[model samples]
Structures are given as structure tokens and as C-alpha cells.
Target chain A: MLVEKSAAELSELLSGGEVSAVEIAREYLDRIESINPSINAYITVDGERALEEAAESDGRRAKGEALSAFDGVPVAIKDNICTKGLRTTCGSLALGDFVPSYDATAYRKLREQGFVTLGKTNMDEFAMGSTTETSHFGVTRNPHNTDRVPGGSSGGSAAAVSALLAPLALGSDTGGSIRQPASFCGVVGIKPTYGRVSRFGLVSFASSLDQIGVFGRSVDDTALMLGAISGGDSADSTSIERPVDFAPGGLDGEVRGMVIGLPGEYFHGVAPCVKDAVMKVAGELEKRGAKIEPISLKYTEYAIPIFYLIATAEASSNLARYDGIAYGYRPSGAESLSELYLRARSESFGKEVKRRIILGTYALSSGYYDAYYLKALKGRTLVIDDFNKAFDKVDCILSPVATGTAFAIGEKVNDPLAMYISDLLTISANLAAIPGMSVPIGLDEAGLPIGLQIMAGHFEEKKILNCAKAIESFVEPLRPPL
Target chain B: MSTMDEKQILRVARLARLDLSEQEMSEYARQLNDILAYVRKIEEMETANVRPTDHIVDLHNVFREDRVQSSPGAEALRAIAPRFEDGHVVVPIIIEGQE
Candidate 1:
């Protein structure tokens, strides 16, 4: 089935004239149609537009005008990433009818590379929640078990790739949004180092920590998409001016004599099966001539608070732009301007988003600034230092991506604190502004996916991708029981 | 060490421009206190002499040569506005419409 082929495999077929882009797009769109009802992975499926783009790709390839190596491959985009003229609701009622006038740089780059745009995938409203239950659209279910949640705020993107609704997807990560979902859904998800991908039209959640990354069935697919979107964009001053380094040298799994650090802190509360699965990979890598050693990121425990404090503060500042006045949901019959701003946000934003905005505002408030946000900043410095020290002794750090596998849909939804812990294990990477990825390690005792996170030092995506590629050789690419 | 109460939450919601319902304010207050209690762990560390890191990768002022860039255009901007008239975003008059 074309829907079952890896993006790279599909590209090879397209290049060989064995299959047409239209056929590939139609197959995936049909798969999305049939399967997405159970999964709720996509918030919007632009089948007509997707077919048109695929046909254009076919035309280009027929005339030797293909845009890039993986031209005509379909990709799902997380809803928050702006696509001009497309409703970029961000899974919130505030922008339910809002459309961007310009495309996000990452999406624009994908289009330039001849990627057939599938549609926008669902995410948490303003990416405030972890399980995507907070999306105004609905919850995206785990393909392995319909009862469990697909992690969020990139849940839909991960779910899309996991269920084979799309071969590849683009997701933004802030405090484990990408990796956590990737782990829960049993797919390859990467959150590149901060500033690796431009955030030009990506609705900002946490400017300092947010990054756009790729999700794929295979590590190479994600690597190729990451390489395509990475590099300097004048539109985003934070976009690093560096050459793309993580492009697919497919199946390059050599890891001889590599030093891998196992942080003792990350495994503390992880489920036994997850720990066993991660340790099994360490054993396999050791047998392959890679050295594994125990290391301490003493500041690991502080990452959650630091990440939330900084991220929410930035989000409160970022989301303040969505006043009722210029281009967004405006309340009717409001007597005052403040009421317009207040009602527009309070009525439109979900509970989680409100909680975050309030907490963030409190953090940045007059007396609490030093005690909360500033303290978090100083604490973040120590976390960065801890990772720097750890990376000095090892090529990369390995750990479980979460405490356990996917939880039930409503398990942590009501308990905000418990939901925040879903991101605990993965937020340290965002805190340090480093590259991290979740590669499906194996199934848990309950048969849900448990992903092993491989994090590398800043700008060192190559190391983690290589290590994940090696791990993939051991576990093979995971397939959920869709 | 401060736990949020409804009054404080109300002030914060006001500052955040959120018109929280009474029930939401109480619920948010409790939730914020719970989260605040958890994040209070940041107080455990001694942060003296530690420089704050706002940006992970050290970036200096990036100066680009001054040049004209195309705007998205007023018409395009107005098209998405919730209430637009006379090619401008329409909102209630600020000073005159106080409650």
C-alpha cells in the first residue's frame, strides 16, 4: 500500500516513475479519510488543494523540474504553523476563523522543496496542555489503543505519522511537545536545537524554547525534512546562520567507540518496562562498541519549573497580541475596551491556556518576579551548565522520554499538575536549548510504545540522529496497531 | 511561598486581560497554587553569582542593512479583521465606553 511506504520509499518510487504523486497523495488522503475519524489527527484536510499540489509535483518530475530530493512526498503540518490563506486557528477559538496573510518560513521551505501539503494537524490550544485534550477541535487518540491519548501539543502531528495518516509531519516543540507525543505515539520526532528552524510564522508559545521539528516513521525521513527546513531566515533574527547538518545519510548507524551518558535522574520514576527497554538499547549499543556511563544532571529536577515559568511568561507576552480589535475573535456588545480584550480571551481560550496565562502573569507580576521567573532563569543557568558538563564527558545523553507510556485520554486531564509532569523528562532539553529526539524503543507491558530520548549538545543534531539511527537498527521502526 | 487566592487571581486575570468567571477564578486560584507549590523548588538552589540565561545560544545584535520590505498590505490585513470598516480595525471607543 502506498500509505504504508516510508516517505523515502515513496520518493524513490516517484523518482523511478513507478508511482505518480497524485496517486500517492490520493492514497494518503483516503487513508486520512478512513482512519482519521478514529484518530482525530487532522483538524483540516485540504484534499483538493493537496491533490493540486501533488499533480504539480508530478508535472515537475515529468519535465525534470523537481524541487528537491523528496519532492511530492506528503507532509502533515501542526495547526499552529501558519499557511497563508489557510485557517491557522492554533486549535483555539480565538483564531477559529483567522487566516494568516503569510506562510511560516518552515512551511514555505517545505513548499519550496515540493512537499505536498496534506493539512493542518490538531494541537493544544496555544500549546498549553500536554495530551492535546485541550484542543478545541478534540482529542487525538493513540493508534495503538483508542482509549489512550496521543501526546500534545503536537499530538495530532505525531498521531498522524504514527497511524500512517501521513508519511511525515512538522511539529513545534516547547518543553517536550514534539518528543513527548513522538514517544506516546511510537514514531520518530525531533526537536532541533533552539533557533535551528525559523519561527517566523509559527504562532509563538515560548520564543526562547520553541522550535519547529519533523516527525517521521523512519529517522531518515525526519532528518531529511529537518535539513530542508533548517538554516538562516532573515524573517527570524533568531534563526541560526549555519549549514544544515542532519540530512539523511540513510541508515548510517555506525556508533563504534561513541560515549553515551545515562542520566540517573531521568529514569527515577520511569515505568520498569520503559527503563528495561532503554537499558536494552544501551546493552545493544555497548555490544556494538559504544561506551555507556552513568552521569548526573543534578539540576534535572528543576527543569519543569524553569521551563514552565519561562515558557508561560513568553506565551503570556506572545498571546497578548490577540486582542479583540485587530484580526481575531471579537466579543459582541462589549461596553468597554478592557472588556473586549478580557472577554475575547477568557471566552475563547480553553481552561489550560487560561491557567497558564494567569500563572505566567503572576510570575511576571510586581513582587513575584524575582521569586519566580527570575529564580527560574538563574536555575535555568545551572541546568544549562549541568548539560554542558555532562556533554563534555559524553557524546549524547540517553533516557526514557516519559515516566510511562500513553495514559488514558482523561487520566491526567483534570489534574493540571499531573498533566505538567508528562513533560518533565523531556523539558530539560528545551531548557538547555539542545537537540533531542524520541525514537520508539519498544512496547511496554501494556503494549503501548515507550520511546527512548537521545539528546545532544547544542547544534549537535548529527550525534543524536546517528545514535537514533543506530537504535532503530536494534528496535526497527515501530508500527502501532492501527 | 505565596499561595494564590481568588483576590490575587482576579488581579492577575485583570492584568492578563482575562475576564474570569467567579468559578473559573476560584478554580484557577487553586490550580495556580498547586503549580506554584511545585515550582517553588527553584528556591532550593543557591543562585549567587550565576548569570541569567535568557537565550541559550548567545546572540548579539543582528543588524541587517536598512532596506524596504513589502508589507502584507492593508487590504489583506483588513480581510481577516473581526470588525473592519474604512480600511481600519473597528473597536469600541476607549475613553467613552468605560463601564
Candidate 2:
């Protein structure tokens, strides 16, 4: 199946004349039609539009005008990222009809390189949940097991790639939204260092924490995509002014003398299978001449609380713009302006979103701000210091991506605290504003996928990608039995 | 950590511009209390002298040339609005008893 091939392999086929761009686009669209009903990974399938774009890609290739290596390749995008003329609901009814007039910079960059967008995939409402169950469209079931969830709010992107619906996809990570799902689905996901990518058309979940990233079947493919979408954008002032060079060829199979650190705090209380899976990957790298050492990130225990406080506060401020006065759904028969705003938000936002909004309002309210919000901000500094201290001893950090494999869909949906803890291992990287990724290492006892997280210091993406590539070469990649 | 009650939940919901039913207010009050109980552990840490880190990236004032540039036309902008009238967005009254 063309859809089963890695993005690099697909690029090779397109360039080698083994397949046409239109054929590749049609193959993925057809797969989405047949398989999407089971997993519900995608909310919209723009078959006609995709084919039209594919035809343009073919014309470009024939005229010797191909843009990049990923020209004519098909990719999926999370719904939170806007697309022109496409209904990009962020898995919520509030945006069920909100089509943007512009495209997200990440997707626009890929589109300029002639990448065919498969469709906008499903996600948690406003990218707020750990499990895809909160999605207004439906829960995106894990391809590995139908009864289990694909961790979210990038669950649909992860499941789409896992089920061979698309070779590559784009996802947004606020608090492990990207890596957790990628781990559950056994795909390679990269959340670049903050400011590495522009946030122009991405709907803000938590502005300080949210970053757009890529999910591919291999590190090489992810690196290629990152190179294409990275760099400064004039529209986004927060985007760093720097050269965007991924040097995809640098993912050589040599890890000799590379230092990998395993944080002692991350290993505590992780499921035995998940811990063992990471250890096995570490042992393989050790044989490849990479030194593995145990280090301390003592503030690891406070990461979850810090993340929740800061993230929810930012979410409250960012989400205040969705008052149905501009672009989203607005209810009728409001006697007053306040009533209209209240009804629109209360009616449209899902349970989790409302909960976060209320929490955020309380955190920022008078008298409580010092104890909750300010304290968390100071703790965030300590968290960053911990990472800085550890990076002095090692090139990258390795740990389990999640506590365990994909859980049954409703197991933790009703239990909010347990669901929040699921992001315990992955949020530290985000809070520290460093680059972190999940690469599939092996499967657990129940035939579910386990992922090892590779994290590096700020703007040290190349180092982590190299480490992930080495681990990929050493471990047998697990394919979901779809 | 302070326990949240229905009145507190309503206050926050009103501040957030969300209209919650009595049932939902009570439910949210319960959940928010539980979540805050967990989050209060950070207060125990001695962060007295540490400065708050708002953004992780070192930021400078980014400026662009103050030259006029064309943007997507108002027609395109109005097309995204749910209710557009006479070249402007139609909205409900902002102030009571104002025409």
C-alpha cells in the first residue's frame, strides 16, 4: 500500500516515477473512506480538493518546478490548525462551521511545497483533553486496539498515520498532546523548541506552551517536515529570528561517545512494561557506544501542577475571544450582550473546556492569584533550572513517554486527576521550552505500542533527532495490527 | 487549598462569561476543588526569591518597517463572519437601551 510507506519512501517513489502525485492522493483518500469509520481519525475528507492539489503537484514536477523532497506527498493536519476554505473545527461544535480565511503557517508552508492535505483530523475540544474522548466529533480509537483511546488532543493525527490513512500528519502540543498520542499509536512525533515554528494560524490553546509539530513513521521524515515548516515568520512576532536548517542527513547511524541521560525522577512509578521498554532501547544504544547515565531532575514531581496552573491561565485568556460575535456559532434570542456571550460559550464549549475556563478565571481572580498562579510561575523557573542543570551532564534525556500504553476509552475520562497524571512524563520538556520527541521502541505485553521520549536542551533538536535515529535503528519498530 | 462551593463556581463562571446550570455549577464546584487540592502542593515549595518566568524564550521588541502593506480585503474578512451587514459585522447591542 502506498499509504503504508514512509514519507521518505513515498518521496522517493514520486521522484523515481514509480507513482504519480494524483495516485498517491487518491490512495490515501480511498483509505480514509474505508478505514475512517472504524477509528474516526478524520472529521473531514477533502477528496476533490486534494486531487486538485495533487494535479498541480504533478504539473510542477513535470515542469521541473518541484519545490522540495516532500513535494506531492500526502499529509494530515489536526483540526486546531486552520485551513482556508476548509471547516476546521477544533473537535468542538463552537467551530463546526468556522472556516478560516487563511491557513496556519505550518500547513501553508507544506502546501507551498506541494504537499497534499488529506484532511483536518479530529482532536479534543480546543486541544484540552489527554484522551480523545472529549472530542465533540467522537473519540478517536487507537488502531492498535479498537476499545482503547489514541491519546490526544492530537489523537486523530496519530491514529491516521498509525492506520495508514496518511504517511505523515501535523499536530499541536500544548501539554503532551502530540507525544502522548504518538506514543499510544507508535509513531515518531517531534515537538520542536518553543519559537522554532510560527504560531500564526494555530488556534491558541495555551500560547506559551502550544507548538505545532510533525508525526511521521520515522525520524528522518519528521526531520524533513520540521525543516520545511520551521524558521521565523513576519506574522508571528514570537517566532525566533534564526536560520532553519534541519540537516536531515545528520541522522547518521553513529552514536559513539554521545551522552544519553535517564532522569531518576521519571522512572519512578512508571508501569514496569513501559520502564523496561525504555531500558531495552537504552541498553541497545549502550552497545552502540553511547554512554547512559542516571541524572536528577528533582522538580519533576511539581511539573504537573505547574503546567496546569500556567496552561489553564493562558487558556482562559486566549479562549475569551471565542464569544460568537466574530466567526463562531452564536445562539439566538439573547436579551442582553452578557447573556449572549454567556449562552454562546456555555452552550458551545465542552465539559473539559468549561472546567478549564472556570479554573483559569479563579486562578487569575483577585486574592488567589498570588497563591496559585504566581507560585506556579516561580516553580516553572525551578523546572527550567533543573533541565539546564541536567543538560550540562548529558546531550539528551530519555524516558517513557507515558505511564502505560493506550488505555480503554472511558477508563480515565471520568477521572480527571488520573488523566492529568498521564501527561506527567511528557510535560516537563514543554514547561522547560526544550525540544522533545517520541519514537516507537517496542510493544508491550498486550501487543500495545510503547514509546521512548528523547529530549534535548533548548534549540538542540539536531542532537535529539540523532539520538532518536540511532534508537530507531537499534529497536525493531512495532506496527499496529490494523 | 480552599474548597470551592457552588457560589464560588458561579462567580468564576460569571467572570468567564459562561452560563452554567445549577447541576453543572455543583458538579464543577466539586471537580475544581479536587483539582485545586492537587495544585496547592506547589505553595509548599520555597520560591520566595525566584523571579516568575512568563516566557521561556528570550524576547526582544521585534519591529517591522512602518510602511503601508495591503491585507486581505474587507470582503474576505466579512465572509468569515456569521452575520455581516452593510460592510460591517452585525452584532447585538453592547449597551442597554442604546439604539
What DockQ would candidate 1 receive versus the native complex? 0.82
Can you write out model 2's per-residue Cα lDDT over B1-99, one digit (the tens) per residue?
A: 587788888888889999988777778777788898999889778898999997789887888778888897878868788788888888888877767
TM-score of each: 0.98, 0.98
lDDT of each: 0.90, 0.90
lDDT of 2 at A211: 93
Task: Give the alpha carbon lDDT tens digit for every residue of A177-204 in model 1.
Answer: 9999999999999999888899999999
Task: Name every residue pair that clashes in candidate 2.
Answer: none
Worst 10 residues of 1 chain A by lDDT: A243-252
lDDT of 2 by residue, A1-482 (tens): 88878888988998887898999999889888989999999999899999999999998888878888778999999999989999899999889898888899988999989899889999999999988999989899999999999999899999998999998899999989999999999999999999999999999999989999999888999999888889888888888856655667766857889899999999899899999989988998999999999999999999999999999999999999988887898888876778778888999999999999989888989989998899999999999999999999999899999988999989998778888988999998889989999999888888889988999988889889888888888788775557
Error of 2 at A34 (Å): 0.4
